[model samples]
Target: MRAVILPGKKEVQVVDRPKPVPGDGQVLVRMRASAICRSDMSLYYGGKPLVGGEAAKTGTIIPGHEPAGDVVEIGPGVRGLQPGDRVAVYLAIGCGHCTYCLSGYLSLCSQWKCVGFDVDGGDADYMVVPAQNCLKLPDPMSYETGALLLDNMGTQYHAQKTLGVSGNDTLAIFGLGPMGSAGVLIAKARGARVIAVDVLDSRLEMAKELGADVVINSTKEDAVEVLRELTHGEGVDKAIDSSGNPAAQNAALDSVRKMGSVALIGETSATTINPSEQMIRKLLKVYGIWIHPIWMFEEIANFVIDHNIPVDRYITHRFNIEQAAEAFRLFDERVTDKAVFVWD
Candidate 1:
């Protein structure tokens, strides 16, 4: 089997390795599509991993969390699934006995291990995962769409659902990357008027194509002011910040109406904001949303299929596993929106 490994410091290696055999309650999948996520750049840049156990710090684990493929083999004790099942692999591996795990919030388990970080992932010809982590893809879903739904689309879906975004709400999204683009699509499906803000014109343009009612270049124009104006001085009904940027985060906090909701989906270690002015005094509701609960995959999939969401439109580039280096480079430089590794 051929796999990709990031040996840190912007290095990418495609190496030959023995195909892994599934252990008890596991399954072997033939890789078909694997999407690159921004978090993967932590390993690419030799920084501390955003999530995982010790194995993630080693930089030897295959680095791909958003992946989907066809099952080829099942291990002992596995049930209800078999060869030829088309599925997307969930990123979190949890201790099934924990309260969080039992409730299907695997990532919240104290003993959780992140796929592609704490363990070998799907950036290869073949990979093995616990049977419980395989989310069966809908018949109408393509491998590319299945892969993307695991992260960007899934996260946005979960966030918007939590915020109760609806026809009466105006959503201001502070970022226009893959995640924000997904936000645009999902928000539009839910009937919300979306306002997208980003520094890059290319990203803002893409946001417009994805159904944003208005796009704001925060660098050229004051995003908070524009959002306020668009909402007739009342401020937006809801806001989401996926840029992980402090300035954008502040803008998200400052641009929503009093008592409005805000979901912060970006992974940032720290940022400063005034509680009194941006949150407390306004009685704002703020949520720190991570990945979706394991059980929510069914609902997310149904929503996408039912709404005919163009999930695959989020992808801007595709590469064979052999082009790992170029893929990482372009994604790191922000030259692509969503990049994926694919197999024939």
Candidate 2:
């Protein structure tokens, strides 16, 4: 089997490795579509991974957390899933008995392991994952869309759902990267008036195509002021930051009307916030979102199907597994919006 590994500093190589056999309660997923993510950038740079612990520090682990494929083999005790079933692989592996895992918030478990970072992932022809982590894909869904559902799309859905976004809401999304782009799709499906903001014209343009009612180029205009004007001075009803940029994060907090909600979905280590003005004074409700719960995959997938979301629209590039180097490089340099490794 051929798999991608990052030796260090944005270096990717395809190396041969023995095929893995599923263990108890696990299934062997034949790679079909595995999406590369911004989080994977850490692995590309040899930095700490978004998930997992010391294990990910090794930088030898396969680097793909958003993957979907067909089950080719089921291990002993794996009853619900069988060979030939189409499923999306949930990235987190947690102890089944933990409170978080029992409640399906596997990523919140103290000892949770990320499939691609902590262990082997779908950068190869076959990857082993817990059968319990497999979510059945609708017959109408493509493998690429299935890959998005678990991570990018699912995270945005969870954030908005938590914020209770709906038809009455004017949703402002900052950072039109893949995550923010997914936010636009989910908000539109929920019937919200979508105001998409980004520093890039390319992303803002993509947002308009995805049904955003308004697109604001933050680099060209004061996003906060423009959002207020668009909402008729009341400000947006819901705001989300998917950029992880400090400025964008602040804009999300500042652009929401008093009592309006905001969800921060991007990963950021440090950012300044004016709680007294941007939060407390506005009586805001803010949330930090990283990943969605395991059980929500089915619901999110159904939403994607029911809304006829153009999930494939987010994909700007696709490469075979052997092209991992160029794929990661282009993605890192922001030349590609959403790139995937597809297998025939």
Candidate 3:
């Protein structure tokens, strides 16, 4: 088997390794597609992982959390699944008995381990995962689309569903990265008037392609002011900040209507904001959304299929596992919005 490993400091290695056998209650999957995420850059730079335990800092684990493939073998004790099952692997490996795990919020489990971080991931020809973590892909969904839905699309779907975004509301999304792009597609499917904001014109263009009603270059124009003007001074009905930039986060809080909601999907260590001015006075509904619950993949998949969302359009680059180095480099430099490793 061939696998990719990031040994820190922007180093990428594709090495040959023995194919892993599935352990009890596990399954071996033949890798088909795996998407790169911004958070992966932390490991690329040898920085502390954004999510995971001490094992993540070791950088010995294969680095891909968003992946989908076909099950080739099943381990002892596994049930209800078998060879040839096409599935997307969930990123979190939880202690099943915990309250959070039983409720399907695996990532919230105190003893959770992150795939691609705490353990070997799918950035290879083959990988093994617990059987419970496999999310069966819809028959029609492509492998690449299945991989992307695990993270970017799934996160946005969960956030917008929490916000109750609909045709009656206007949504201003900060950051036109893959997550934001997914936001645009999902918001449009829900019939919302979408306002996309980013510092880069290329991203804004992609947003427009994905059905944004308006695109704002925050660097050239004040996003909050423009959002207010577009809403006839009432402000957008809802806003989401996926940039994690302090300025954009504040703008998301400021650009919503008095009782409107905001969902912060971006990962950020710290940022300053005025609760009094942004939330207290307005009685705003603010939510901090992370990945969707493990059980939500079915709903997310149904929604995407029902709405005919162009989920694959979110990917801008694809590479064979052998091109792992250049793939990570381009993604790190922001040259690719969504990059994936694919197998024939």
lDDT of each: 0.94, 0.91, 0.93
lDDT of 2 by residue, 1-344 (tens): 99999877878899999999988888999999999998888888886666678878897898789999999999999888878999899998999898998999998889889988899888889999989989999999999999998899999999999999999999999989999999999999999999999988988999998899999998799999999898889999999999899999998898899999999988888999989999998899999997899988989988999999999998999999989999999999888989999998
Residue pairs whose backbone atoms clash in candidate 2: 10-44
Error of 2 at 130 (Å): 1.1
Clashing pairs in 3: none
Residue-level lDDT of model 3, residues 1-344, one tens digit each, is 99999989999999999999999999999999999999898899997888877888997899899999999999999998989999999999999999999999999999999899999998999999999999999998998888888889999999999999999999999999989999999999999999999999999999999999999999899988999999999999999999899888999999999999999999888989999999999999999999799999999999999999998887899999999999999998899989999999
lDDT score at residue 223, model 1, on the 0-100 scale: 91
Model 2 residue 124 CA deviation in Å: 0.8
Return the lDDT, model 2, position 280.
91
Alpha-carbon deviation at 215 in model 1, angstroms:
0.2
How displaced is residue 188 in candidate 2, in Å? 0.7
Which stretch of 10 consecutive residues in model 1 shows the poorest summed lDDT? 45-54
What does candidate 3 score on TM?
0.99
